[model samples]
Target chain A: MLSIRDLVTSYGNIEALRGISLDAAEGEVTCLLGPNGAGKTTTLFTIAGILTAKSGAVVLNGEDMTRLRAAEVVSRGIALVPENRLVFPRMDVEDNLRAGAYSRRASAAEIAADVADMYRRFPRLEERKDQLAGTLSGGEQQMLAIARGLMARPRILLMDEPSIGLAPMIVAEIFDIIRELNREGVTILLVEQNARMALDVAHKFYLIEGGRITFSGSPGEIEQDEVIQRAYLGSRQG
Target chain B: MIDFIQNTVDGVMFGSSYALLAIGFTIVFGVMRRLNLAFGASIMLGAYMGTWLHVHYQVHVLVVAVTTVACTVLVGIYVERLCFHAVRRDAALASMVSSFVIWMQLEEAAIHLLPERTYAFPGLFAAGSYEAGPFLFRTEQTAMLLLAAVMVGALHLLLHRTRFGLALRATSENPLAAAYMGIHRTWTVLCAFVLMSLAGGVAGFAILATDQQITPFFGLWATFKGLIAMMLGGMGSLPGAILGGLLLGVVEAHALWYLGAEYRDLSAFLLLFAMLVSRPGGLLGQRILSREELAFRRV
Candidate 1:
């Protein structure tokens, strides 16, 4: 379980996340749906400790992780699949996956086994194991990014905009992967602009607007809300 | 023909030291994407420490070499902490300017410690020349060449076959993503500085030991030569650095022989200018991809 309480993060004078709080329960997918510039990515970054918070706390289970750096955050079992699927462009797919497990103190044999598991999970990666990650197709790169995050063996995975630029079919496939990951008992905190797809897999969803959580509800409750219908579903007939 | 071949041979032997120096610069540049102008000054200070030890305490050549490398690493850490670590990452110009100021400070510090225009640097090997098949090789230059090769081989292994090297390369490729992978950016950059400083110290020793002398101008000379070599070979490529150094050395040697010493530097710069016009990427440097091209590749 992860609890974020009144987290405030800023960039100079502009506050990107102004006292926003949310939670992702254990073994569940919690989706944050927001428009562009709605502090979606900023919230994920602040939770991953890539951006330091101005105030409040990020408690994973119970321990305070508010002041930890990104490296420490990963070591504490929170791995972020950053927006844009920012895989190491020049490195081969295998090395990129190897880099994913860098924070763990696992032995070579153990790490190799985990890498093998990734290869089995995503066969396309194994096929292009020796190819530079940048050369992979957009869909393949997204898979590699997910596999890389999974390589960290985190207690919770935070994925930001994994389907942002992918094809429609690939977006569906990515959501399927997300559902499978959750089914396998990995907790997930996902940020998405695709409310429809995210709502299908997410156990609970929160709608964020202008750096604040405007709505939070079950998938059924969300479907009946007029604001969700007009703003997210693009339907005025709600 | 014999004269040309002889100059080339001499150039190559001397160029090994240049290659070592270029490697130092390239490694730091590769990791940080910022220039540390104080690289040469740090090496100069380290060499000054060695020369002081030799002059006052009459230490062994081995002791001087160790002192030089250790001191260079210390000065390098100081520069990293003050100029690089203190500055904002996005303000690369600030880091460069800070390093430039540190270079002046380091050079002045070295001069204050020695207060001499020139001092003798202890040679690693006895003064002698070997004649083989009508070619002459100085003992120190030969040693430099051999050591440079060994160092390059060792460094290649360290970069390719080690976990630390992987982390370093990842950091160089993408600092933010590397952080997501839990690679400590500051620690990795510090390690890179220390690694390059070790190489720079050895390079400074080799060059000084071969010349058997040191002066305040050596810092400027080392910086320019290393910078030019790095640029010539391609900025960040390791092999490019080595190739550039050898090419610069050979060209300078021929110039010194044919056009006189005045044209030596001129010829080297001219080659760099021509290379820039013809192929701006250098002999082995890859053309950097534009953001659009990179995005296109992903799709």
Candidate 2:
């Protein structure tokens, strides 16, 4: 559903995304795996139109979204969960969810229904609906962030490092939520350092390094690659 | 005892105007995290414009008010476009300097428009006073108090109960995330200036009603008091701004009553200094901007 071609993004004099390109098909979990400072987040930001691209195009279902503003990008049906789950800390859970639907002109009834649907899916958030988001536990805050993104009712949801810093059990729960969301046919573009978890969920994977796509293949092919196993999976020998 | 009660009552009535001005000043700061030094100029312009319309054309009070508000809002948009928008991404100092230049220009406009240094604001109400036990009160003072309350209450409702309020708070908390959710950053900033400009109009009207005179210098005085009131309450705290304004008024009133008029401005500055030394963040402020954030590096 999304196509990026030869995208180049920079911050001042330093280029973070240098001619990187990738594709995320409709109804699939596409994962981008890379080490620190590998431009994984930069790629996602450029695609979301939060950062301007020096060169390249981001196409969503045949329409170019590269030059659109971030809010306009959301209107075109793309929602980003953002790095670090930057939920509105002072706003209540319900308010944050409401904020997600800001770009939509949906009826009040539809919004209420969607909010209700979110509460039903994440019962913990339902219980803490009135509490400030900052006061929630890390797991709960992560859930709120995802729910906030879903509130946009976008066809494509981009999540960055959804499992970083969560407990193992919580991480598993997050993965389950991702799977559940994908099953509902929401295309996901996931950025993660957890190669194992990403490999399990993603239908296609791209490994990026130094602002370039180093490798691209199906998870089956990636698991069998010796170099990737040693570098990303910590194998004993390549 | 009667004198003390009388001064306090007057102070409170006058404080409502200060509260309105400070609230407008602080809301813009809270949302933009930038100081709008030209806000005082806006207040001055509002007063001058309203008075000029009333005095020149014998316009109705309501008409004067509407015209003043509309004109001030447009001027605010103009100031944002001219002074604020370009420097927004640069640094706080850059915006402050730009706004200061605009402020001086606004004063110059006022001087040229009104050759006299001061213009008497035709009273909005008739010459009347009411007596409550030993206290005497002007009818306009009570009206000013009521108007301020209604305005603040309406503003509170707008911020808490509306979707626009949600978007505003979201933008204030994190502009990038707000943009991700489809809130237009530039529109939000513009809306903030609009809201503050409207507040400035109401405040200017109340101030003119109380003082019965409008001067080019009033803009600087209003800005100083508004800034002091905002800081005394806390930078980002709404209720804190209102309370701080009221407190400053009461403090100044008592200082003038006991120590003579010379201490009036001195007391306001002293209170500000005391707050800075004891609680640099103000009474209700959660956090002061760090050096980097204050410089607009982190925002």
**Model 2, residue A78: displacement in angstroms?**
0.5
Model 1, A54-111: lDDT tens digits are 9989999899999999999999999999899999988999999999999997888998
Reference contacts recovered by each candidate, as fractions?
0.92, 0.92
Cα lDDT for residue A11, model 1?
95
Compute each candidate's TM-score over C-alphas: 0.94, 0.94
Candidate 2 lDDT, B151-210, residue by residue in tens:
999998998877788888898888878888989878888888988888878887777776
Per-residue error (Å), model 1, residue A223: 2.1
**What lDDT tens digits, residue by residue, belong to model 1 across residues B32-108?**
88999999999999999998999999999999999999999999999999999999988999999999999999889
Any runs in candidate 2 off by more than 4 Å, and if so which? A236-238, B1-6, B289-299
Error of 2 at B58 (Å): 2.9
Per model, state how many residue pairs clash.
0, 0
